[model samples]
Target: MNNNTPNNNLTIESLWQFSLQYYSMREIKEACLNLQNHFHGNVNLLLALKWLDEHRLTFPSSQWPQVIQSLGRTEALLLHFRELRRKSKQHLPESLYRDSLQFELQLERQQQADIIDIIHRIELSKVEAPHLVDDYCHQLGAEHLAVIFNKQRL
Candidate 1:
């Protein structure tokens, strides 16, 4: 299929701009590399080639700022998880829950504390909840049905 249109003044700049709409930095970089093999003097190609590290599997150089911010946030969230796990090991003091079932329930609640609030406020009418659950399960590979089931029970 001849993709080129006569009305369009097709150039590297136009293609680059159009590509930016749908292609990620990595995809753009790959396209740039292919373009470089055939054409020269395209700064976008140069940026794409040099933006990547030696492995060709690292982050885009342009996203370093957001990546750094996300890394910091992730580190803090991980620390929170670690401390929460430690707290779980030590136990939250049985005095907090008089009944054993209460303790079990509380533990389950704590396990999902991060997402519980969001789940509670979720409106089933506004969105398809099952799809979200499916996507989450897909991301985790194997998910514990008990977690979502328990949350639904609440």
Candidate 2:
């Protein structure tokens, strides 16, 4: 468990790209949203965990507080915009809703960038993918997501 020198292959852009592809799958998207809605899980963190797992990297439990703190403001904004979008669905015109969704996605991308910055600063260990994903999802009290995430691993 080194405290520095993450794998050279693990770039923020790569993680973002991986997230975009993985989250595009219908099952993965639904599971991620379910974890967010039901377990108060951060979708970006969830995807980050999966991304780390795919790369056989460990996101130490000790780093979670830092990650959470870094994401606080953006997460709040994402939730706020998401709530507004959901609440306004019936009242807002289709084009407005689409714009709102796109804005929310922008916030989501920012959140992912924030997560990636923290990742770049932290120490990551190399370990089995399942263990990382399982441990993380278990900590989130969303073990079911571990299954889905593992099954859908690219």
Candidate 3:
């Protein structure tokens, strides 16, 4: 867990790429959605944590609140569209639903960018990667997801 890598590779675009590749997996995608739907967890934040874990970097604990706050607006919008997409499935045409889903994905990417911005502003330390993700999942009473995430790590 203490395998810290150089931070040279850490970037806004890198995080988005990591998230896309990671979330495309069926198991990780389902686990993330489970945490989001049942535990009020932010999937972007979860992915950010995982990305940080992969990079062997983590920000200070004090910055956690700010990190959460950064995505508030976007998270709300995501949830709204998620609900709309779910509820409108019966009435909306498939094309419209696909558009809505695509927009939601865009919002998700924006959220990852926002997260990386916050992380960039904070002082990060080299530490065991799983600690932050573990703490967050435990805080949400979803330790199972922490396990899932760790197991799914590349």
Off by over 4 Å in 2: 1-8
lDDT of 2 at 1: 29
Compared with the true structure, the alpha-carbon lDDT of candidate 2 equals 0.81
Which residue segments of model 1 deviate by more than 4 Å?
A: 1-125, 144-151
Q: Which candidate number has the best TM-score?
A: 3
TM-score pick, better of 1 and 3: 3
User: Could you tell which candidate, 1 or 3, scores higher by lDDT?
Assistant: 3
Ranking by lDDT: 3, 2, 1
Q: Per-residue lDDT of 1-154 in model 2, one digit per residue for the tens? A: 2555455666677877898899999999999889889988888888887888777787677877887787886977788879979998999999999998889878888888888778777777777434766876788788978888898878
Q: lDDT per residue, candidate 1, 1-154, as tens digits?
A: 0222121323334333433432344544454444333332222322221211111223223433432232242344444554565566547565543354454434333323322222222221222232332232333342343133213210
lDDT of each: 0.32, 0.81, 0.83
lDDT of 3 by residue, 1-154 (tens): 1234355677778888888899999999999999998999998899888888876777778878988888976887888889988999999889998888898889888888788777767777787544878878998999988988988876
Stretch of 10 with least lDDT, candidate 2: 1-10
Name the best candidate (by lDDT): 3
- TM for every model, in the order presented, reads 0.22, 0.89, 0.90
Candidate 3 local distance difference test against the native? 0.83
